[model samples]
Target: MRRLRIEGYVIVSADGRLANVDNLMPDELKFEGDKKFFSAALDQADLILHGRNSYEDQPSSPKRNRIILTRKVGTIAPDPSNPKATLWNPAGASFEAACDHAGIGSGTVAVIGGPGVFGMFMDRYDTFWLSLAPRVRLPDGEPCFPGVPARSPQDVLAAHGLKPGEVQMLDPEEDISVTPFRRAAS
Candidate 1:
């Protein structure tokens, strides 16, 4: 059996917001270093899973196999907008099945998301790359994990048995940092 590792990638503000009030990621909230890190990670993944909203916002990348998670069943089909993408409903198809549908047999699977998508795979994440801009705070923004009662992203990851690793400074001037939390060894 091929063991598939699911990894989550997210960029949040100091306040744990993933997006602004409009449900859109603002320019000020974006950092070049974080973008490069995430893009490189995705480039190396065998499969990428995203929520419908995030999938729609992403530019088409034919080289990467992607699955867009949706709630509407019976809509499992190739995405019309992106040839390398598929619309999948987890309720009808398992994650393994979705990977098979995308022709991914093994290796890392990147889960890039909206809050629900991130929350859905919380328990399965082998590692979560959480990048944050300490100086940035979105008072009225969407959280990294919606409806999660945890006060902070760290608390949420800790609740899932992930232990925080060393923090890497992505942008010193901007005070942006990336932290990797790996599942504790059994």
Candidate 2:
């Protein structure tokens, strides 16, 4: 069985503007603190899977193996302009199989969001790494994850049989939210 991980930052505001689809790095709120945590998490994963929108939002680089999921088939290479990232259209093997091929066996295979991608594999995702920024505020932007029936993370986790780990606060000054989850053993 392939391991799936869902991880992203979402702003819990009334308007849901803080978690914009346009912004690649929502945790970058004029502080290096959040960036540090994200960077650390990114390092744990050998491969990164993201939706087309999230992939396009990122600056092309060769630092890590990237998989962009889309509908088209026979597409496996990253953009010619940026050779670092790889594109994976639904082909002979499913996206999960492609991640296994990319050598994500035991290491973390992070599913960065575009909403649909997260929703598609929410049940299959083994771990959920979430960061809650406490102080900074965004009044206008798209949501972090969309299209799922409105429910608290706790509620969703209970439905999926996931449990939270011991709470670890990053910065008391920032009042940030740092949450992590893992699937409970069946």
Candidate 3:
């Protein structure tokens, strides 16, 4: 059996928020270093999984295969705007099946998120690259993992059996650091 390694990438504020109350990630909150890191990671991945909102917010990339997660069953089909992307309803199809539908054999499957999507793959992610800007705190913002309630991102990852690796400072000027959390080996 071909084992698919699921990876996640997220950038959060010091208070563990992913976005502001307006559901928008402000430009000042975004670090260039994090963008470079994530872009390079995606460049090497065989497939990418994103929530519907995230997918719609960005311009489509025809070079990379992508699956946009949605709740609408029977909506699995090629995206009309992007030939390289597919709309997938995970409730109607398994992840493996979705990979097959996207013609992905085996490789890193990067899941870029908006809360619920991150929570959905909490148990399956082999590694989660959690980048944080400690100086920035969005008091009334959307959390990195919604429905998780009052827990730090580290606590949430730990609860799901992932051990945090050494923190790498991506940008000292911006006070942005990335901690990779990997599932403990059985």
Candidate 4:
């Protein structure tokens, strides 16, 4: 089976109340530290998966294949500048199949997103890489993961047959925080 990974950040309460997407991204997220790590991770991804709104933030010079999911956007035939970038519409079957059909068959599939995308693949994801910017607080911006009842990462993992992997302090110099969770070994 293909290895599917969901990697991104979300804000939640200690008891499990998650912030909504409409309040997630804001001027406060402009941390140089978080930016560095995010860029680094993007470089490491074999293919970057993103929703419509998230795709708008894509860097001009991407080092890996970029697979954008959208119901409205049609195929943007490959160009010299975007030889590996393509927009996919996951009509129904697993997004994994969409990725496969788009030639994103192996390596890490980074699911960078808007909340709906995350929620759609949450249960099927094999791993999750999360970044926590404990310092930046958005008073009225959008939330990270929205909709559905909020649940701690642990609870969500258990429900999806996933398990905690390792929590690391990324970019100690910049104080960027991150954690990685993998599906329980079978």
Every model: Cα RMSD to truth: 1.9, 3.9, 1.9, 4.3
Among these predicted structures, which one has the highest TM-score? 3
TM-score of each predicted structure versus truth: 0.92, 0.73, 0.93, 0.70
Encode model 4's per-residue lDDT on 1-186: one tens digit a residue: 665455654433233323424644555444565566667777777777777567535473355777767776443333344667766666644566567656766677777776677666776576766665555444433444443235454566456666666667664664555666566655
Error of 3 at 52 (Å): 0.9
Scored by Cα lDDT, where does model 1 land? 0.84
**Global lDDT of each model?**
0.84, 0.58, 0.85, 0.58
Poorly placed runs, candidate 1 (over 4 Å): 55-60, 72-75, 147-150
Model 3 per-residue lDDT tens digits across residues 37-112: 8888888889989897774233335688999887764847777777888789877878788888888879999999
Q: Which residue ranges in model 3 land beyond 4 Å of their true spot?
A: 56-60, 72-75, 147-149
Best candidate per lDDT, number?
3
Clashes of 3: 0
Candidate 4, residue 56: lDDT: 30
Looking at model 2, residue 133 earns an lDDT score of: 64
Q: Rank by TM-score, highest first.
A: 3, 1, 2, 4
* lDDT (tens digit, per residue) of candidate 1 on 64-136: 8899998765747677787888789877878778788778789999998989999988888999999988778
Q: Which ten residues in a row have the lowest lDDT in candidate 3?
A: 53-62
| Candidate 2: tens digits of C-alpha lDDT, residues 46-158 | 67777777642323235777777776647454545444555677654576666654655555666776666665666766767655664545554555555323655445655
Candidate 4: misplaced stretches above 4 Å? 1-24, 56-61, 73-82, 92-97, 147-149, 152-158, 171-176
Q: How close is candidate 3 to the true structure, as a TM-score?
A: 0.93
